[model samples]
Target: MRPGVSLRTKIYGLVITIAVIAFACSLWLSIDNTRTYLNEQMQSHAQDTATSLGLSISPYMDGNSPMVVETMVAAIFDSGYYLSMVLTDADGRELLTLENPVEIDGVPAWFIRYFPIQAPTQLTDINNGWQMTGQLAVTSNPGSSHDKLWRNARNNGYLSVFIGGVALALAHLILSSVLLPLHQLEQQAMAVTHKQFATITPLPSTRELNTVTQAMNSMVTNLQTSFTQMAMHAEKLSSDAFIDPLTKLGNRRAFENQFIAQVGEMQDNDLATLGLIQLPSLQVINAKLGYEAGNGYIRQASEVISQALAHRTSGTLYRTGGSCFFFKVASAGATVEELCNHLHEQFSALYSSHYSEGFANIIATSYDNKQQLNPLVSQLDNLLTRESSTTGTGLVYWAPEQESQLQHANGLHQWGEIIDDLLASNQVTFMFQPVLACEGNQTSENVLYFELFSQFLQDGIPLANSELYAMAELLNKSLELDKMLLQQLLTIGDFKRDVTVALNITHQTVHSAEFGEWLEEFYQHNASNLPTLVLEISETAILASIDSSIRFIQQVKACGIQVCIERFGSSFTSFKYLRGLDVDYLKIDGSYISDLDENPGNTHVIQAASQVGHGVGVKVLATHVENETSLRLLEELACDGVQGNFIQPTKKLAPYSEKKQCQYWPI
Candidate 1:
């Protein structure tokens, strides 16, 4: 295809060319007509002079008084109107002649040469009472005629130029107006290429362009609809795989899957709290009040538990069994006591209002990442069984453990002090986990980038981000902590080269205008020393403050940093949000990737996520890819990247200059 000129430019050029030609033709005609009229006037003046002079001098032409004739002709010639005048005797003897050289003033020589004016000479006979003498000839000077012609042509030329200029301006505006819609359509088309679909408004008035715009709009609408449906399907697959149909909570499978993932991924200092709520007489209720009533009671229990867990982060609720509902959360002692108290009140009310012989038993426990799931579940089961055998309605109970450990571990004030001390002393470090791109059967040692996990050191032990961020939020020091971590990351000189790092941010930081401003300024000064930076905002954080997240992403992207939607598929929201966010990567949450090959439904969910992410040009990455089976599954699903223990365990962040390839990468 050949390079094409814009319609607007072509039209403007044509209009200008035609205007110039028309202006030239019009000026030429006006000057030519004026020149002809002035020549006729000059001829008339010369003829009148000659006739008057010849009649007057005719009476004195009797072969004498030659001086009188000469004086009369010389007088007219001296008036500077005539170029020359002459008188002759009857026998054509010697005559007196008067003449002056022609010279025009106030006109260029080129103008006079280009537009020549003819100076007509008039002749009349001098008769002495019917005896004619020689002729009297008079010629007019062309200076005045040439000057008039030049003035008329110049004035006409100036007026034509002004009119042409106005015409060209109006043509330019009209062409721009006519082509404005086309420009919008071109932008729309380009946006589609980038997987962004949009419609143009205020369609062009031109019939042809309007039809074309309508067609374009239709095409965009169809594409948008297809993508929306694709995303919705992906979301539905994710929901179906993880969600329990009865309570709309995570099922046992999801809980166990995510439980293993969280334990492996969580820091040693992080605390995990678990609770089990059992409706002891659910079978009896089903036999007595019908299965519908049993289902209704189960739903009521789920709702009550959900209400108790409100406003809490990192909490997961699961319908582990027909009569067993469970929850695991990263929270402190005060939160666990609150949850138990709330459940106690709600269950007591349900028992008094709806049941006569039935009660709910609640048992809870707290531990660090070291505890295995089987022992914790066994302990909770034993406690609940003991409580169910003999208890008041809806009894709140806790498994026996070391009081000093729970107090020391779950104390909010202690965590606050520890966080303050950590920030004060700048005791912050990061663990960089390499994300490797998928290459089918080919194994490459190259890394896509490393995700930075912030760790706060307390007594030489690394504190989990969940714990640090929770304490920071309670102390209203989230922005300070985030800024410190970002500053620390930026100060690393080793990040100046081929290294790329993604830093996870909290919901508070995502919505903090001050943080945004500080980040922009900091990046401006230290951009050269920075690696390829990506701000990872969790899927839940984006949903929590969507507009703010969008603004923050755009703002940071303007500074040349990329963004990633981390923990994707953890939330059951529509994929439509991805349309509004200009993100570079989507990190599919680890739960879906854990034991991926064992669960067939998770395959479709991951496939759907991959489709949606790739549809919008976003790279799809799997987290917690722990085994060869899971890794192979992710590769088969066409995932763009994978990061987990199987790839490389999180290690202390070191300069890439010191270690080009981590130990995990095959040589």
Candidate 2:
């Protein structure tokens, strides 16, 4: 793009040009008219002097009064108006002569050279008693006339310049006032590009500019309305698929998704605690006081547990069944026994106040490490039922073994030290999983990019990447960990030259100003050797600090990096917020893609997500496509890409050379 001159400057130039020309013409005309008038007056004065002196000299025409004539001529010449005078006899012989040199003061020599004044001479015949004796000539000096014209021209020039300067300054002020609205309109348009809509207030009074301002305001209003509607529709679809309608919590589907993604796979020495709350008197309460009463009880219980979970960031509450609520908290916080006991106290208070004869129960259990999702929930349910049958409600119980408690504490302590060492060492291991494009009926040979997963090792044992992040977050080491991951990824020369790579970033990293500044500098220095880098942020992380995340995404994208929102649709946060984001891809959470062929509800959710993404010109991708049916389903739903075991399992990222191209999955 070429540089543009401002309207103000252009107008100023035009006004100045016109003013200069007009002033020059006006000054020239004034000086010309004054000079003509001065010449006429000088001529009239010289003629009058000559005629009067001729009569006076006529008496001396016979040579007897020559002295008198000479005296009169000399007296007139001495008046400084006439340059010279001569008296002659009737026979044309010279009689008396008077002459004076012409000189002018207070005017420049150059001015005289450029503008010369013309002088007129007058002649009369001298007569004595009706006889012509001699002739008299009177010539005017042009020095005084030139001096007068120069003074007038100089004064007029000064006045014109002062007036022109004042006019220009006033014109500048007027132009700035007139174009103020245009500047506002420009800023408004730029704001819209960043998804910030601002309207102009106190509209400009100019007819044309006012019309334009109104039009811009109307257009912004329409866009904001449309963007809001699109977001709301997408959010509704997300809620329908995963949210429990009555309790406003995660439904069974949401719970299953959360379990598989976060809880199903656990690390050694990491505790997994599950809590189940059952409203045992729900049916009896409904029979006596109606379903509304039963709903009230359920809502009350959900509220109690919701409030308890609020104090713990890692806790997740779900309405897994009609009368059963499930929750999970991180291992580093309050033990399972304390949580269960506290809930029991709350439940006991509710039972005493609302249902004097009815009862409720709470049961919980903790495993030392990873366990099957179904068996764990079933075991908790069986324990709750056995307790209710034996003790008859109002009971709070837990699994007998508390061995996981000590192991979890020890593991947390070990993790803190290990994470500090890893951060200090500035190293990490990376595994690459390919995200391949989805083309209908054809196995796509094209690899969209490779997503990187980071892991930490302790004494040759691979620790859970998820737990490491959890611990890092707890210890405020998330920023350091993310930095190490990016630094390590950049060392792989093969990926930089041949393909793209996507790396996950934590919420802490996304919000940290230090991290943002570091990333910007890193990209600037390594841009040439950098791959088509894509930063993958979780859907929840963005929703947590939406404004900052948007800034971060925009900042990185300006540096030529791509962004993806991974684990999308897992959170019930309205998808409307996506309209405000500038993203390249939306990686649908694996839970939604896992049973795509069987889960009809998730199909609608994914379809809505795909439509929303495409609406904003972003590609939608499905994660964890483990089977042919799911892959076919995703393709039918218009998913642009897919990633999971169906394509290829994650493998260690190895160093490569320029001669050998990186291997891709089978087409």
Q: Give me the candidate number with maximum lDDT.
A: 1
lDDT of 2 by residue, 296-388 (tens): 988988988989876544577899767889887655323446667888888777776457444557887765445667898888888888876
Evaluated against the true structure, the overall lDDT of model 1 is 0.79
**What TM-score does structure 2 among the candidates reach?**
0.67
Residue range 1-667, candidate 1, lDDT tens digits: 2158876678778888899889988988998899889989999999999998888888778767878878887887899988888776777665988888988989999999889987799988877776787898788999888888888888888899888888888877888888799889978986775467999988889999999999999999988887898898997886777778888888887888878777777676666678888887788888999999999989988887887775565666789779999888665455566677778777767775456555576877766768788998998897777767755344454634542353334566777777778778888777788888777634357678888888777777666566567656656777788788878875566553577888888778888888878888998998887778888888888987778888898788878888888889776667888886778899998888877767756888888989898877889999888888888888888988889888888777765445654674211
Clashing pairs in 1: none
Off by over 4 Å in 2: 1-179, 202-212, 261-274, 287-290, 311-313, 328-373, 387-412, 436-449, 490-494, 498-500, 513-533, 545-562, 582-584, 614-619, 632-641, 657-667
Consecutive 10-residue window with the lowest summed lDDT within model 1: 399-408
Error of 1 at 229 (Å): 3.2
